[model samples]
Target chain A: MVGFEVDAVLGDPAIRIVVCCGSGGVGKTTTAAALALRAAEQHGRRTVVLTIDPARRLAQSLGLTELDNTPRQVKDAPLYAMQLDMKRTFDEVVLTHTAPERAKEIFANPFYQAMSSTFAGTQEYMAMEKLGQLRAADEWDLIVVDTPPSRSALDFLDAPARLGRFLDGKMLRLLSGTARAGGRSMFNLVTASFGAFSKAVQKILGAQLLTDLSGFVSALDSMFGGFRERAEHTYRVLQDPQTAFVLVAAPEPDAVREAAYFASRLEEGRMPLAGLVLNRVHTSAVPELDAESSAAAAARLGEEGDTARVLRVHELLMRQVVRETEVAAHFTDRFPLVPVARVPAQPTDVHDIAGLRAIGDAF
Target chain B: MSWPARLHVVTGKGGVGKTTVAAALALALAAGGNRVLLVEVEGRQGLAQLFDLEPLPYAERRLGDIDDDLRLLAVDPEEALLEYLDLFYKMGRAGRVLRKLGAIDFATTIAPGLRDILLTGKVKEATTRTDEAGRRLYHAVVLDAPPTGRIGRFLNVTAEAARLAKLGPIKSQSEGVAALLRSPMTSVHLVTLLEEMPVQETTDALAELTALHIPVGKIIVNAARPPLLSSRVTQAELKRGLAEAGLPTDRRTVTGLQSEAHAHLARQELEQQLRAELAHLKRPTVELPLLSDGVDLPGLQHLAALLRPR
Candidate 1:
């Protein structure tokens, strides 16, 4: 009734990259796995799904207790999955850019060290780097990704560019000022701060960080350029029509609004919009009683005092369903045309491949 | 414990100005003559930027003259990792090699919830200091915690990870950390904006905190939008205002007896969001004005002024 026709988007071959994105706890990761499963089993294409999420629940979804950075072959023909280890990958890239010595110096440098680990955009940039790696591998016919559920998902687009700017930014130059014009040593005053920090580091680690920093910087030198250039390539790859951005959300107002924001962002950035997936949809045809009836049932159970907890649970579930319904309606009104596929909530946690398969069959 | 040390932990959602708030609050408590140690996990160095100082490392540094007693430190994970390692085995040379290979990195970085435990460990150590300084070197330990989305998992990391590692330093540390988190002296503050998602997350966060036995001290509703209209009004007044403003009339527009009927509808929506949040019945709520820009030192000071016990 909301004009969401799912087949039209799914059957399109040009829809190469399906990005599953939404807020946390809204089943975004599970939905992504389902979509990949569907594409492989139903659509008959080899698919690889990459998740930028830090949550370790991916193993539970894939019927495994844990996963690593490498792609694990889950089922037959079309599905392969891997959780992106951004820091490890970034470290690898850093090692490729500069000489071992220079890389060590750079990574050990206090400023670069600070920016690499804790800066905001690094995750986004690293995600792009992962995308670039996957797109170039071309091992799969389709590539899917589950993005981090941050308010700034568009950072997926802006991250690489931001990183490039930062690497070339005045901040680096300011820090570099501490290095001689020949890039030999830091300025005198900064040396004192580093000295204080180093003393603290020595107090804590007994001069081990100095040695590790040296090794890390040396390895990072060769990897820096590759990381930057590949980030740029990923940015361009996302802009291509082959990369279809699927914005996933729940029926809730907040979830739909986040999806709407993502869609608007894709439009603003000229990124392709493939479709939308609305998971955990609830319908009135649940065969459940209305609120008044539920209240009566709860009161009756309480009066009998035999099954009071059961009746209370039923009432709570019913109320939650109604609220979920309201949230879903808000989403329907906002996103009009992007093909939306709805997956209803299940009675239990998705802990096995069978569960994932049932979710895939929702469409 | 005297006044400043009486309250121990400070926490809130990320990007809601937790680090800034912690910095300013530390400064305020220091101004009121208390030794405060502002700590951060996940190695963000946000405190350095907040105080307009050079970058802070794993060790604590005095944030001079924000107050004489106010101090800040960003506990580095690598440093924390070393101390943790040193407590158990001699890292001699091969241990250093293992650390370089990121063998120990898993303990801090990739380990499920271990980082959170270590992070909380730093705060707990700061809080429990009975050193002969008798000065109570840190009367308060303000922690810049992770964002709300993953905070439940962050704080509960110790208990959850401890379940996996039955008998190791990790387990012992986690158990010790969990005790401190569940203790009464620690108070959790949830910082959220007036927006739909943040408020919703705040509610979920409150439930999670309560379940974990973390006493939520207060809900700091950051960047709250001003009330555009009063609740007491009739349909006629709404219609007259809408007609005067030459706006379209619709059922959704509150009968359009006033100029801002449409805005009233929007306001009603916000109220609904707030109402849904209040349904949880946890902790008192405080509101702050929305700022034109992200919070800085001056802005944090202003916010701290509001947070001061009236």
Candidate 2:
């Protein structure tokens, strides 16, 4: 039931972290960018925005030709931006936790490469890892993060535990343990050693590939616990009062439903939710008139004239306005205390700093 | 020639109405009197909620009046794997043992490709299933697949399953699923909105599908609004129209009309620009109206009728 006071959150010295989360195509990234820009330009806080979107629209709008893992300061604003390179972040985590030789061996593993880049939930996990790193650096007064665009991103709360379980799974330990024992006794050791499960795995994966996989798993097993520990620390940080979660949604049924779904999730997780921001709301010019009256008036005005056409256009607008009101009311009724800030749909997509500035003004 | 494929994988950026579009397509295809099974793999229960029906179980259930031929199934990876094991290996009790031993979790997580294989294998099985007369059980199977972000890997089952399990029924099953997916009998439709981010993601999905060698189907644009006024509305014309309407001379009413006219003009421009950009993708396209009553059964039927042409 928190009132989403964007400027108030930005102005508070104690509130250092802002997380913008929503389903994809709901302008979550744009909201994060605008939040960062507003915090930096108006509130005079040094800010950085991290986004997981592969699209370089954020980079292009920030006037940068390209964005890599490293944060770069924007041209005129007091803001910095960076795109999370999942594979690079995963590699860095591995390299930091493992020996140089072992890390190199792990890096060359095909399975490792694939998991680091394209695994279902890896981007969200890496994004959380990056958030922890940025917070630890203590450079920016305000940090805004745009969560990855996936329903799975909501399961980020379980990432650390899941990764931990996968890393500590018996198969890895058994494979690595046997790989170090010796290749000659590998089959005998696997069969006499673990159980039918390991035997099935070995027979299925083939001897040569099993050897390569075991070598890879064995080399990287030491740092297994660190990944989970860091993720857990960040998960705790997300629950801190200093962190504000802003749920953004467009004025559509699906998007609104998703926003509510995410809000409830944040509540369950005990994350500090600032409030909901309803983006691209349609506010009609003729607010007092009902849709029925407007339609009737347009019909009575006749259909063949320019005036009639204009009235017909007005009727359409009125209907949209009425529809938007009903949609808005549903959210308000469901989440009574969740204060909403409505931003009108822009005539065009926000491309440059001016567009961001205009949005800042609108809100 | 109606829809062109027995299997249609409906995918797009998140929040772009993939569920609605897929449901509409399923209804449309079934309206042709073909038996259709619409399967969802993400475990979203999106179909149930979209239709306001009971939450679908992993097992296929017949949705009520849509058609006897049109059925919906929510496929969970875990259930799909167990079914796959039981079906392929006839390992009913052994499948329970694999679950207890965490073999299922290992395959699903450590070897993520198997998850996709399980999902696609179910779809392939449905499409390839035949009755005594050799007529396919489901003439059409519409898959509400994963989003564009993961679809490339999701459909590249052959390569991924090969990377992990080199031999056994798993490898052979994955190859079979891959063959169906890569064949002319499969088509993937990408749903998107006429906005910059969605259009960008649509293009990215198209490029990835091209690289994956999957044929692109129609581009379905959801929640599209009709243009009220052309972008070229002149200020003088607007003023004259307001005067000719003869409804109001009050300052407030006049101002309201003017603002409404301006907003409509702006929207028309934005719509044109975004749609023009999306058209650059060069795929056959379908546009569905943004319903005023919001998402409902009647609205879904409206969308279904709209998708009938495609």
Candidate 3:
């Protein structure tokens, strides 16, 4: 297997952004953090890692508790880490894009409050929004992004467009138009389907909810174009040669399948997929001792002896190694050209700088 | 043996085999002539893949060969919303018009918590659905719910929808769903691996679910691997054992095998520590062994047998 040159990506002066995306529980957050740390410590680059919903200990390790939405330097290193606060980022975008009164109105709207905080796609969209903001600031030599733990790996890529399309869709336009016209002009619209649409929406969501949503939409109407443009710009940044998308996955069926799906999706989108980081890969110390031979040796010795127990352990490890290899091979076989960096499974969870440094070393 | 709850909402961190666990649990529940419905809400069509069937539609279909009483449903928020409207307002043509105009998408996707409300609303319907004789149609309902990170908010439909709909059928429906979720008839079982991140998320989710007053059931430890060797075994013994067993006694091979054993023991210790921590949570814990060959129907049946109440 060809090794993914982690240092090449880290040391490359042209690559300004590295996006680590994968299925959840595959150590995407740790990968992003380690990459950022490596870029800072090894490559001597100013780097900031943006993590979305890191584990509590991982957050504490990165000093993310003290820095909520803004990047703060972790210890003395040039590495900086910040957990994404989606609502705050959304509010910041609104405040920066609109006037104070309009921002306040938008913030005060119930629907806006709900959408900003708990909307299904809000985190993904806001993560991208924050990424765009970070890149546009031009303060860091490299930026590493940890995509959100969405139900599907593709959600992080599809969310911004989905939200943008929803906001710019005709339904919202009609609703905002109705709100702007005080509900009278909807009847005067060109088509009866429009009336039926409004009635149906109103019937499902109720009259007050529609009013609140329209109020929120009208407040956000001026910024919808900006939202779409920013998403597209960030997307282009992702597609640029300067940015690299590293798909991370464990040597498991589900995670590898997700990585395959994401790799294809990135290819379809013309996004620069640098390589795949196969995390938590298991390997046997003795490649010569196959599982079958080890199991046979164990059976010959019986289970009570130390030699038998060692052989049993060797058998188990060999089986796991084979399983992991086969699972990882699924991805490598599908995408033969994609370089893979396998990070051996660590005995303990990574929650400190030394742990992250070890992971970077593994890469 | 009766289950603890009629509705079992299985949630875990992403990639933790919650869908597999839920399917197996449903199969277990459907044993002995009991009817069970396994629900998937994430639109992932995971149930279909698990059962080796085609992508399931909104309607229920029997999971053949596994258990005749076991059924599967992939709930779409759009379909759920339309059904809700038809049930409440009878807006048949208006629903079609809304679909044509993308209002359905707008309502389900754009409206905060509306999608979750609709999804759980469907689950609640299945849970409480009764027959002509006023008997429960399904003996058990297993929901392959959202991940633990959002399970609390996902199940808390009333509070989530309160911001969107202050006073309407949506509000009332969410209220009803919330009531059912908070009732003793429902249990939100958390699935986790014996790893740091999943266990941490499970702990956090347990705290959150407890605070939200949702009934939590067992803590399912999925993909648990047993300790292969005793901790007292020494590296010296392993080298001697390797030579005695006619394996290569070379430095590299011995060292490699020793290191692999070291990692394996270390991982077993870590798993033991995590298991102890989970035990401190005071919930009944069920540990499912790792399926080395990966999950298929027979594997799923094996898991179901393990999940079956003794």
Candidate 4:
């Protein structure tokens, strides 16, 4: 298999944005940070990494004890790192697009508070929103985005549309009393089912939640149009020719399966997929010594000696290498054309600039 | 003897095999001819994948031909919400109408914690359910919950909802779920690998669960690798042993093998360090070995046997 040209993607001036996406705990954040650091340090490009990892692993890797919503420079390098503050980003969007008083009212609404902080898709949406903000700023020559650790890697792609549908959903408008004033036929349908519908909703969510939701919807009604439009605009930016998508995964069954799914989803969405970063892949030092032969040799000699133990260790390594290869082949065989850059499993966790640089060197 | 708890909530960092652990635990509980329910709430269809079945519906289905005692349920929040309405308010027709109008999506998705509330609500229902003969419907229920990063918030969402609802069935239901989650009958087990990041996340999750007053179960260490070589094996000894084994004694092969052995030793040392860290938490810990062949039905059974109560 041809190796993925990591440096080529990072150095390509035409590709302004690179999005690293995969399932949770697949080293997506590490890949993004490493790519950004390499672009800034090796390729001599100004780079910024926007990470949505709630654990803040990127901050520790960048040697910053803390990362705020805004980008901070890492050491003397041209690279900048920031963790997405989903709630604050949502609030900023509201505050920027709405009047101060209305923004305050929306913030005060319990539904708005919940939606801003704990909503299912809010992190993905805010990550996109922050990406749009960073790209519009145009301070960095390159932007590397680490998507949210969603259950499905495709959630980042689906979030904008989901949020748009929810904000423009007829049920929300009806609950907020906007549909009653918009169309006569719609108003008739609303009136016909409004009593029963609201009764069910109220009964399930209770009257307080319904009231708060209605208040939240009405307060943010004016900004809804902007929200959807911006979401659409950022989504378009993602689809632009200048953007590149890198699918990161470990040499595990689930992660590789997700990467395959995400690659196909990107193809369906007309997004440019650069390649796959197969992280934490196990490799055998002596590939010539097969697991079967090693195990047989170990058994021929008794298990008591150091030579037998060494043979056993070699056997274990060979087996792990075979399993990882088979697991990775599951993806590569399906998408044979997808370039792969396999990073050998590290002996310890990456927690500093040197460790990230080593990863970059591997890439 | 019975298991330690009737409801086992298995959570871990993503890719740490929580779903697999939960399934194994369910199978272990069912080994004694006890009826067990394994539930998945992430909508990831992980149980379906683990069991090699089609995507599971909101209904409970038998796992396989091995036994009739074990069943699986992939709880969908939307379905749970509609079911809740039908059960509590008898709003069957209204629920369908709401579904068409997108109110169901709004109620389940837009509300911050309502989706989680609905999910845990259903789990609580299964935990406390009784049959016509006044016998427990399930002897045990194992929940494959969200990862540790969100486990605290996911389990405690009912408290937040209770504060928000303030009235009606939602409020009472939230309070009921909260009580069930905090009760002694429930135990939240955290699964982790012997790696820095996962162990760190496990420790943090333990603190959060403790602070939330949720019952903490055993710390389950998954994918633990056994030490293959003695730590005292020296580089010179390894080289001599390779020559004695009739393997290549060339410098290149010797260098490669030595480097590999060094990495293996370093990883083993790190694992030992993490084991100590987890031991300091003072929770009963269980270790599951790494399955080199990847997880399958037989492998799951192997794991289940290890999980069986002694």
Candidate 5:
């Protein structure tokens, strides 16, 4: 297995986009920020980091009061940052792709509002949308995008198709027809065509709201292909050689499986995986003190003494290193082709610019 | 935890041990002769993998034994949707018709409010069910729910009810689910580890769940590293021992000792911060020590013992 050289990956002139992906709580946002900072400061590449949820860590590091859709320049660093606002991104898409009246209709529609914000795959879709926008703008030399640590790594990959299917579904066609028909079509014509299906929907949503939903759909009809095409474009950008997917995972069994799952999923999609970032790896300073030796030494010191207590702590530390190494070995053994970079757990979480820079230096 | 709520929704940041906590909680409840049903709503089949049992399908299957008192179910979204349709709408033969029309996929995957409703709806159904003799079919139902990021929306389906399915059985069902979620009968427990992100997410989840009127229960801090040092051993003493260990201390060996001491101090420092952050969440918190070799079937049983009431 090749050992991952973070410097080489960050400094590569051919690489422009780095995507940090993994299951949740893997320090993905931090990894993305660190890589972006490294690429900008060390590699001298102008960088912009795209994150779904930065919380306070990114804000503090970037020296921003808050993040919005527009990429804000990070203070005293050669990097830019923004948190994805899914609804705003969706609204921008609708406003840009459709007429003023239709945009108003969509923005006002409750169903549209719900879908744009809380729908299962909307954030994933908007993340891709925003990525496409950032790349198309060509404003930054390196764009680091952080995807949602979804329940499945495939959720973001599958969103475009699911969205296309929903938009192009027969229900939308029926709803749009009824809404557009505006009571002009014969009642029997509607009954004969939609009968049970419309009946089920009408029973739940009532006539007025269903009409509103269908109106929203028909208004969005002109932009359906545009959205799908953009998804394809983003999908292509991800597949490009200039792009690298780094899977960040903790030194835990579940996190290891998650990383492996993501690796294979990326492979299936033909997306280029740069390597695996094994975060929070427990490494020993005293690797020479074998566990057996440490335990024996502690036993000799007696259990109650201060020195014995130190050995006790030493044994715990030894056990942690042993476990973390096995977790790393599990990854290397499974996907030996993927290079692994280990980041030893820090004394504190990364909350500021220097912390992110330290992470950059760690790998 | 005596007579823990009938429906326990275990959720946390992605890496937190939600599945382990759910399985352990089920075992803990079942130890008292309660017929507990553990459901994996994320569909990871984590239960089957954790217990080393056969993979659970959409239907409930006996998972080895939590003393014959626990059953496992991986709530497949599609199957759950279909069953909901059959039970509520009595769609019967029309289910085939609906699937042929791609309605099922649209509902489960494409529809925003509908998707969460379907997932939460299944848990509600399982928890509220009864047998022919009028006794509860399952004494407790534990759901390894969606992570903290999505739990609020998953439980708060009322928005969808009010907007999409405004005035029908679906709306009422959504309201009923929300009510069940808010009631004392249900507990939305946030699971986390002694780490920043997980603790941060747990705190955030607690606020969100409380804001949504969902009963926020215990904060489970999982995978904590047990302190191996005696209380009296100071950091300096540990470093001193590392410096003077009974051996020919070479440069590499000294560096190793230094690294161990630094890691130990860092860990202890971080743990203090994480514990303080968790305490600020204002919920009763239970800490589960990090198990060696990573949590397995036996480890899960031991974890269950931890969750058990004294």
Candidate 6:
């Protein structure tokens, strides 16, 4: 509908993955859908947009009442989409890498379960796992993912490596008796902390906590490399050009600052960034008959208090614009090469596919 | 009823409806005739939205029947820094320089885990604030804290920083803040959904908070759905309801059958979650009804009523 030409991020036909990442409430899901929609409609590729946001923001955008771990086709767009159930994805990863008995053993472990579901990088790691699965799919030509709002959006790429580092780190190895120093244990102090911690943990969790932790850690020790290689593979796929990363943000100060931080983080990591999609930006192109002018006109038309009302309205709208401008500047100032497209704030929530298409038009 | 616990720190992961709970609690407290201050840090400005007011700033704005008794303050980090410096170090010139340099914002944003210290510090100030006549103006202060994931690290950092900054004003203040935080008088309320991730995170958050000696008051499970499936036939009927609603189907995805299967399994999972959560948390567990529409003011007020003394 517009004169803009869409650029292929990965650039290689063989590369069919796109990762949409940024801070919270930045329309990451909308951007991912637009990209997936474009890939399907323009390139004639069957695509899927996956998200890890528990808010179901993308699911709402795509007009899905509720999305599970499984991808579903929506409105004949020749695409499939889903919000990755993090716990489900983690379970799938465990099942794929470990035996059923081993998986059960791992799941039964309290420490392992806690780390899998509630730790800082769990969502990021699960997202990477979901991406890997989608990339390996035979049916879809393109797979688009929307990552979480944490600073660790890309950290899942390093999760396996980080896990390996964790295992190799003094803490775990010290527990494993692998870091033998002078044939004496170096984990006495840590062990004591762990003992006090375990007792506290046991008292809190009803005395079976350490048993679960030991078993879980043991299972993790056995199947560590497979998980690492999977993570490393996802990282490589993400770094590839065919897998373009679009950073989404709103024109709000906090949202834009987060986007700026994310962009810089990506730049440091040398990730392939496609562009920035600044959603819900308040426009300055409204007629001169805005709150300020309208209020003045109202007062002049014999309503004394009307002018104050109009000025107050204008002040509010103006603040909105200023916030947007601040956020926009933050993005453009940092990433000069990356293009930014603005989607004006809608009066209502984008809960339908038509609304999603309207957002998609901005890209 | 036992002094209504001096301060209630309602915290959870972001977007778990902390501000909503805080608003409701204030209204409930006021209904029970206690002057309260609903405080929010991290500058989310969510309280104004909950109260259906225009976006609020650092100033305490009075609203509703709760007003005259209850006051709401969304603590601005910059204002908190000025107050802190003036009250503690008495550094008038240095404060201006720090404000000009955006050092206050920098401390809130860039540094590792300092935002928590600032946030906790602000909440502490609110809970401890007295009137000009040296009377305790607020019977209670409800803090809408950061989400559960960060709360543990947030509390731990101040205690950690106290050791690092030992002998300075920061050390003394950090230790003071830590004592209040760990005290039984302050209770942390975790808001969660009935879903897997939230339930699991609640458990983890509770464990972490307990380890830090922070007392948990209650668990407010938001957006909890009633059971849709009863008997096998009812489950089948539920599946039909979903299928008629325009869910897509393909050879691989038999939308009717597969979704029902997933939904059925999900129901069982939610049941397990309920059992686990109730077993774990000894405090009063309040189940908030899922709203058919989005949660706006009326919905939050209804929720607040549920938490009130009947």
Top TM-score model: 4
Model 6, A1-363: lDDT tens digits are 111234445234675777777654455666677777777666777778886663444465464656478888877566777877878778887888777988888787646555665554567778888878877876677788877656333454444455545533444443444445523455554554444434432432233433554455567665666776777787787777766777777665456656776777777777877677777676543323244543444344443232223233333445456555765786687667777767776644455566666666655
First chain of model 5: TM-score? 0.91
For candidate 3, write residues B45-131 as lDDT tens digits: 888877778889999988778535888899999999888888877888777777887878888777658899889999999999999
DockQ of 1: 0.03
Q: Estimated TM-score per prediction?
A: 0.52, 0.92, 0.96, 0.98, 0.93, 0.56
Counted clashes in each candidate structure: 37, 0, 1, 0, 5, 6
Cα deviation of A159, candidate 2, in Å: 3.1
**Candidate 4 backbone collisions, by pair:** none
What is the DockQ of the complex in model 3? 0.72
What DockQ does each listed candidate score? 0.03, 0.45, 0.72, 0.69, 0.50, 0.03
Per-residue lDDT over A60-153 for candidate 2, one digit per residue giving the tens place of the 0 to 100 score: 7675565468888877777888888888899999989988988889888767866787676777788889999999999989899998877643
Pairs that collide, model 2: none
Per-residue accuracy of model 5 over B84-146 as CA lDDT, tens digit each: 768867877776676766667765654567777777888888999999998889888988988
Alpha-carbon runs more than 4 Å astray in model 6:
A1-15, A54-68, A149-164, A180-208, A284-295, A302-319, B1-5, B8-144, B147-310
By DockQ, the better pick of 2 and 3 is 3
* Candidate 3 residue pairs in clash (backbone atoms < 3 Å): A285-B256
Indicate the residue-level lDDT of B71 in model 5: 86
- Model 6 DockQ (Cα-based): 0.03
Q: Docking quality tier of candidate 2?
A: acceptable
**Deviation from native of the Cα of residue A64 in model 5, angstroms:** 4.2
Scored by DockQ, the top model is 3
The weakest ten consecutive residues by lDDT in model 2 chain A span A185-194
The residue ranges of model 4 lying beyond 4 angstroms of the native Cα positions read A54-58, A61-67, B232-236
Q: Distance (Å) between predicted and true CA of B227, model 2?
A: 2.7
Candidate 6 chain A has its poorest 10 consecutive residues by lDDT at: A304-313
Model 3 docking tier (incorrect/acceptable/medium/high): medium
